[model samples]
Structure formats: C-alpha cells, structure tokens
Target: MVFQIAISFSQSIYFPPSNSSVWDTLSISRLGWCPDKVNDFYNYLDEQQTKSFILLKDGKIVLEKYFGSFTKDSLWIWYSAGKSLHSVLIGIAQEKGDLNINLKTSDYLGKGWTSLPPEKEDLITVRHQLTMTSGLNELAFFCVEPGCLIYKADAGTRWAYHNGPYDLLKDVLESASQQNINVFTTLQLKIKIGMSSGIWIQVPPNHYFLSTARDMARFGLLMQNKMVWNGNPVLRDTAYYNAMISSSQELNPSYGYLWWLNGKQSHIKPSGPSSVPGPISPHAPEDIFTAGGAMGQFVSVSRNTGLIMIRQGLSASDDLSGLDLHDLIWERIMDLGCITSNSASQKKESIHLYPNPSQRYISVDIPNTSPIEAKIYDLQGRLIQKSFDPKIDLKGFSKGIYIIAVTDKSNNLIKIQKIILQ
Candidate 1:
C-alpha cells in the first residue's frame, strides 16, 4: 500500500511520490558539508558498527547510508525504543475515552496485577507506569507476572526504569481498548502515519517493533511535526503529546513517557540510581529528544533543526541504552560543522593521523603549510593533552578510546579522529 506523508517548513508543505525508492534529497553541498567529510562520518559510523543510518531535513532525506549487507528494505528491531510507540498508542486510547491516565491500573488490569495489598495496589495508576514511577520493586525487572511485582515505594514517589510495569501497559491498553495491541497500533498509528512496513513482535518482557529504516524515519517525522502527519492529526490531544515529550516526573527530568529527552539539567540511566549532570547528549542540540533502544537503535527528533535521525544496528558499547553510540553520532555531526557557512572550505584540507590503537605514541600529518595544534580529549570532552609536536606520547595514558582533534591557525577544527590506547 502506498502511504502519503507531508513535510512542513514554515507554512510550506511538500509531498513526495508514494514510491519508497523516490525520496526527496537535499544537497550536501548546499548544507555546507564537504562530501569527503560526510564520507568520513559514515566511515566512523561503520567502524562503530552501525547498520543503517538515515537523516531527514524538513521531512526530506538529507543523508541515508546502509552499511555492509544491510539494505533499505532490511527489517530491524527497535528493541526498547518501541516503548515510544506504546506511549503514543496510550495517548490515542486516552483521546478515544477508552483509557484514562488518572485511573488506577488495577481498574483495568484488575486488583491482582501487583503483589501489593488492596490499598497500595490501587495507588499504582496508568500514569505512574507511563512515567516509570510505578514504585514497584524491580527484583526481577524483566518479569511482569504478579508475583514479581513486589511493592517498594508508593506510586509517583520514585522513578526507576523497570520493564515489568512498562510491559503491563500493553495489557492495560489491550484490556481497555478491547482490541489486540497489533490491531490497535495498526488502526491508530501505522496506517495514519505511512509506517506501512512496521510490525510488532512478541518477545518476553517486551513486545519489540521491527521496520525498515524509512518507516522508522516516518515515525520520527510524525513526532517532529508534533503527532501530525500530512496535515492530518494522528494524535488530537496536544496536551498529552507535550507531556509525553516533557518531564513526566521529577526523578528523571530527561525522561518523558518513554522518550529520552535532551537539554535537561540532569539525567539518569536505566539501572542508575543517581542523576548525572548535563544533557543526555551534550553534543546534540538541547531541543532534541529520542526513542533509543538496545544495540544502537535510535529515532531522534530535533524540532529546532527540523531534522530527524534514525539509526539501527549492533552497538559499539555493551550499554543496552546505547548512550555511548548516541553521543558519538552527535559528536561526529558537530565535528562535520554541517550548519556552518564555511564548513565546506574548512574541511577541504584533510589531516592524516596514524598508528591508531597505538601502544605508546601516535603521529600527525598535516598537509597545510601553516602550523597546526593537536589536542587529545577523552570521551567526556575533557581535554587530556595539547601539543604542537608531530609525535605525541601516550605511554602514561590510560587504556581507553580518545579523540585527537586537529585545529589550524584560525582554531577551526579541521579533523577529529578516534584512537584507542593500549
């Protein structure tokens, strides 16, 4: 089936053909990105184990690259990122009057949904589940059975990323809507937003969704437009949409219903107890929010830039939340200087750094006649060392990944390369 989508900029809308192969493209040169630098960015993504990457500007395809054997039609799992899909469906159910966030989860799932007593169990509401504040003990966090849901604190008092409570939301949605999760999602979201290739798969503890890279981008565009698609309202309730992307609770200010929000003062991870300082992705724009998943799956929406970025593949790190990979992508994008007017000319000169994964020292080769400076920074953007010498010592450096940044006389970043110290 052919699905239509609308890309809006200011008051203008562009509708591309329904054919999947015919996406509108934006000029990389006009965007001030050097083609070679963009290739370097893709090379970095490939080295970091990305399978598919797509970037949309104003709902038009700006960059789309598939690595190795992965193609445009490849169906990949979204993992926990699918939670955002569920969150939206919940909003639709509320808009249809089939479910109410204010009502207790027990009202729909019955009183025995949790092991807590009548009074405590009744306190756990659908809203609490959506906010990751169900206050249920996370002993066997992956188990959604009643016996596994022991009480810890009262609902809305604490925030913990527990999957059991979140998984139960599907049950709540199913029971209240009197429709299967698949049916509800199809009728409410996929069909409306031109996510024609998406499908949900039942996995233990969570129901994961799989789709082509373009379909995921379609969902990102839907979010970028605030739940509207092709000038049609997919989600009519603006208040709920705002809440789903804003702070849903106090404990994790960087988290919404199931989305990972940027620009907050502090943020917490899935298994972390304390909130960390700074935005989830310091290199990304503050207004960006994302639906992230295990093994590097991401659907990022940035309203300020009118861009939607989607990535899916094996993770470069073991972190299930893909925080490192997410930050790395944004860091590379910033290094590309895509939005800068002189970015193309600035990237014209390429610097070669050698002996990567070095044991002791590395060398830099600059083609420019002018003197250049090199600075080494850790993954957290902390400067480790700065030097004018071609050969820099790494004998005392700890064993980890570090970025080598090269700047010219004007202090413009000409090249950035990642190296591992052994």
Candidate 2:
C-alpha cells in the first residue's frame, strides 16, 4: 500500500506557496494535493526512520523542516557523499598546481606500497582511485596484510566500489595540497564560497559535519552553477565540471567521478561487498548529478534546470520512507518555480513548430494563435533567440541544439521542442 501510494504520488504532484518570503508568514501549499500530503510524507519518513529535509530552488529556502532533535543548525553525517567533497578538493588542488589527476598515486605515497605479490605498484593512477576501478578488492579495507589493499587487478581493468581505493583519494589531495582535508576544504572551497560556517568533522564522539538544510542547499546550488558562487568561478575548470557530471564507470553509468548521475542508462554492479543487489533508478537524470550519503542524506543538482535540492534522513538501503517526504517536498518546490519539466504533455497541444532542424529558415506554427510566444535556448540553458508570431524566419539563429518553448495565456508550460539549426 505504501509503495503504491508512493508510485502514484511521484507520478503527479505539485506544491504552491501560500505565503511569501517577499512578505512574511510564508506558507506553501502542495497543489493537486491535500494538507495531509506533507503529513503523509512525514509519516512515511517516520516509518523508514528519517531525520530531516531541506528543499531549495532559485537559491531561496522553500521548505526547511526537521524531526526529532534536528534543527536549523543541526549538521548530519554525509557518509559516502564525503567522497564527492574529496573529489572537488582534487580539482582545487589541480587549480592550485598541486598534483595532476593523470599522475600515479605511488608517486606521492612512495615506492614501497604494494599488495600485489611484487608487480602492481605502478598500475594505480589518480583516475583509477577517483573512479574506484583501481583493481583493488572490497576486502582491502579490512585486510591487515602487508599489501592486501595494494594487490590484484591492474588499473582500469576492473570496477569495484571499494573504500580501500577511494580512501587513498584523500591522501592524494593532502599530499598534493600540503594541507589537511578540512583546512583545504575551508580555505579553498568553504571560505571562498562563503560556506565556512557549516563545516565540521567527527572525532570519535562528535559528528563528522555540522550544517543546516540551507547550507546543503547552497552546496548543491554551487554545483548547479558549475562551482560558481556569487558570480565567481570557484572551480575554474569547466572541463572538470563536465567530467564530474559524466559517467565514470561502465559498471554504473550513473556514477561520475565521485557524484551520482541520475537519468542515465546505468546499473549498479552486484559483484561483491555491496549493500544494493542491482542497479536502481535514483529517479533523476543523465544530466542530473548529486551527492548522496548513508540513510537518506542527499544534495541533488540539475544543471539543465538550474536547481539545487537537499535532504537528510536516517534509514536503511532502498528505503522509501524519507523518499516519500522528499517527493512531496519536490512537488511543492516545483509549484514555486524551483523545479521545471520540459515534457510535451505539460504544454498545450495547439502549439507547433516547423523546420525542426533547419539550417537557417524556420517557422513557428500556432493554431488559432493566441499570440504564440517562443524563445530558443541552448543546451547550457542560455537564451539566444525569441519570437512571437505564426511564422518567424530563423535566419539570425545560431547553429546548435536549442529548446524552443512557447507559453500560453496561463503562463504554464506550453509547446517546447528541440530545434537543431545547422
């Protein structure tokens, strides 16, 4: 019953804000949903043992709530999501001219490190360590043997989600930057991006991180803008940004350098030492990427839509409790202009376009035309052209893939089509 409702709710749901931050007493309503929608989502979280959720859109706080002891200043563990932080540090290290990603890990860690009888030390590269395909077995994390984590398959030959391989990534960054991970993150990223306040680390009894839901949102937004904060390019490498979002392994096409790509044709490997049995849809996009952690902690970003969303929860693997809450939260944010869907069904059926992939000349087709409006945008979501008419020539348009969307009288989703002008 829970699963059925979850599927249905995910299919169609929207949230509309009842109050405004522009004023006060801001209350958002979930369109096409009942007040119990939020309650139901919360109930589901309770069932799955979730903790907190923070949803943001357009760099504004839309939904911020917590459960149990959670609060506006509470910081939860990011778990494996920490790996992404490590990955970003690598990029920063490169920007600062520390170490190159193509270099061998042994170069910094020294020549004596090896688990492979005697001949595999030179096979591991920084790329292998970042992608978790360094040929190290899952057991390497636990093996106390001299070089258990350093032996076996050669770099790039095998793909495994082993901590032993990725754990070294932190070491590489520290070695390259000549500073600890925390200090580097603070000075290079956190402080630069104005996120130094939300940083923390666990030293046995204390939590590893201290951040509010909004802080996570900021982090997600930074990724959405390709590591640009406040109009400044903090990352400095669009190529690394592209690589960060691109698939890193054949085993899981959804897995990028250290981030998780949604909507990709990929599956999780079920080989060995994994919590999940098979690859599962994270209900995202091939262009969408995220930082996911144990339980339900998430920082999802969509470069296409320019969206940043954050969620924090505590649950077992593949659990749907906290996820339901997140779904409802998303629905509300969508209504508030935080998320967008570019589907034909969401638009009017009366709008049309001609010369789908024209070199220069094209026409805008509208039925009973209510002053059909249209705008063209590139894959990077940049607006290049705009027209309002029944037939407008595209002699001035550039040659590239573009999205031509026409809005109707209601200002809702209208006709949106892909135009390739060669």
Candidate 3:
C-alpha cells in the first residue's frame, strides 16, 4: 500500500537545515500546556534517572531538557532501539535491489550461519529476523554462534525477542551494500535526516547506535513523516515502510519489523512467556508507535497528534527493557495534556483567559454553567496560587508563563489555559 502523509496538526511541520543544529522552538504556553504540569513531568523524568528528554510538535522543539551534567551534545546509546535503525536500512537495501527480505538467511551468510541443519537454516529468512520470528532456541539468549542457534521450531512459527538473530542484519547489510554499517547508515539516513550526531558502534553481540537527543528526535520526526525528510524521500519503499510499522505477523500484532506499536489489542513483550492483555501503552494515542531500548531510551511517534517524544538515560525500574518506564512517560504526557485529541465540544468548553500578556492580572472566562475553581502553576508544575474568583491578581508573581487549571468541585479537569505575565 502507498504510504500517505496525513498530518492532523494545525501547524506546519518544520525540518532543521541539514548539517546544522538550528531548529525553531515554539512557546510551551502557546500549546495550551500547564507549565507546572510540564515541570512536574520533568521532575518525574529526573527522578526516573532521565538524562535528556525532548518533545517535538509539528517538527519544532516544544520541550528540550537535560538533567544534571548531561547536555545537548552528550552522546547516548540507543541499545535495542537500534534494531529499528537496521529495519530501515534493510528497507533501503531492498529498495535498491541489493537484498530481499524474502530470501533465506543462508543466501547472504552462506549455509553455516546456524547450527540447524541446512534445510532448517534455509527456512529462516531475512523477514523472520526482522519480525523476531526466527524461531531460534530461546536458550541461546544473546548468543549468535552456530552451536547456540539450535532449532526449536520452524522459522516463522513463533515470535521471540532474540537479539542475536536481529543483530545479524548488520552483517547482511554490510554484505549487501558492500559498505560498513556506520558508513551506509550515515550516507543513507543520518546525513539526509540531519542526524549529525548519530553513529553505530559495534559491541560484541550487538551494535549500538549513539546519538544526541536532538538527533534522536530528528529520526523520530523522519518516521513521523513516513520516512520522508524535508520533502526528500529517505526510504521510498512505501510498501516496506508500511509493513515495517504495521503488524508484520500474527504472533505479535504490536510489533512491526523491530518497532513496537501501541493501541494493538494484544502484545507479546520481550522475554515475556505469553501475549499481554492490552495495548503496549494504554495512555498514548492509538496510532502511536515507538522505538524503545534498554535504560529508558525511547522514541515515540504519535500520528494522530503529530508529536514525537524522545527519552534517554538510566533505567527507571528494575526491568532492563524499560517498557514500564515508557508507559509511565505516556501517563505523564497525558497528564500534561500534550496529546489530547481536540474536538469541537472541547474547543467550545475550553476556558478563555484574557489579558494573557498582562503585567499584573488575568481574567478567566468560563462558558459552562458549572461553578469552577482555578489553580495556578508555574512552568515547573508547581502550584503557586489558588482562587475561586474569576479574576486573579498576579501583582507579585514572577514575570513568565503560568498555567491555570480549571476544574469543577469534584476536581475533574474542565479546562487548562496558559497566560503570560510581562
């Protein structure tokens, strides 16, 4: 199927100039987000050991924050998220007629890549590797040696998150493209997408891609735009791109060519024995997909909202896979009202705050008949003031953006508005 760019956002998307770090930033208040809520979100991230976090709206930086000594230039490993990188490279290789995923793994690696007898090895194709359905013995874990690749079932019969087979794609790409993985990635994806800081470094059983948070956001934006970078086709194989992000097999509906998809009815998580009961992230938009890795690294793209969020740092929990932290970030995002789907009723019900750029005071105009209470917060999600009156005096308040969360007596969020104090 032809992949179409159906942007639902009202704002025009922005792309940073190639080979430059220059990108425009949008005011957080303009997005109708509570600064205090945003602050709270960051505090949660910091507590979770987040080194860097970024949120992009319409391809422009809405929020970019770093914790402690971490800076924009600090390099971080993507771990298994780099699996998605390999998937894209394989798509490009196929588009160039250099390799076909349908071909058997032995076609490129020769017959002895696996200990499984020749016939059994031949059954494993590049597609199986991409979909994590190689059916290799789970006992092998991270082992790729032939002795460790004993056959447990027919290729494509099962789905298991084995890193060994997936990592072999780098070798396949190297052989097919007649170039190093890093060089091929740079020429094909990094340079084109302005991922100036991205680099793939081989480390034993796997290859890790290291990049800055902005560069990771650039890649997420590329995927958000359906592999198109600044109107230039980065990977024009629409069919492959579509398949890469959609359900690739029946075993794992929430996985697509090494990428994790949200909103699917059921999903089999990494190392889990069976499929789970619900979507990967219940709080995120239904159309969202993600590239997640160890240590809380993530690049989540929401098609419904035209938003891309990236997080990288130490693990937030004992789970090394970081899926739990990924869901937690979505919860915080939901609280911040970042991805709330806008509707006509919602717009009408939205409270209006006037004299927004006021120096000393601001007034709230509620359209609903229900009595409302207001609480004010600063950019850090800190509650600074509370008032039941429609007009609040900001006489001594700091000169900056403030978030006013309006709610009913039951504490249900009625509306949120951002006002600027000069």
Point out the worst 10-residue segment of candidate 2 by lDDT: 1-10
TM-score of 3: 0.80
lDDT of 2 by residue, 274-311 (tens): 43422233323225576766666778776555445677
How many clashing pairs in candidate 3? 3
lDDT of 1 by residue, 107-199 (tens): 999879888999999999999988889999877878998899999999998888888999889999999999998899889988786666888
Looking at model 3, residue 415 earns an lDDT score of 61
Candidate 1 — which residues are off by over 4 angstroms?
Answer: 1-20, 338-422
lDDT of each: 0.80, 0.59, 0.81
Which consecutive 10 residues in model 1 have the weakest lDDT in total? 1-10
What ranking emerges by lDDT with the best candidate at the front? 3, 1, 2
Q: Give lDDT for model 2.
A: 0.59
* Model 3 weakest 10-residue run by lDDT: 1-10
- Provide the TM-score for each candidate, comma-separated: 0.79, 0.66, 0.80
Displacement of the residue 316 alpha carbon in candidate 1, Å: 4.2
Q: What is the lDDT of residue 141 in candidate 2?
A: 54
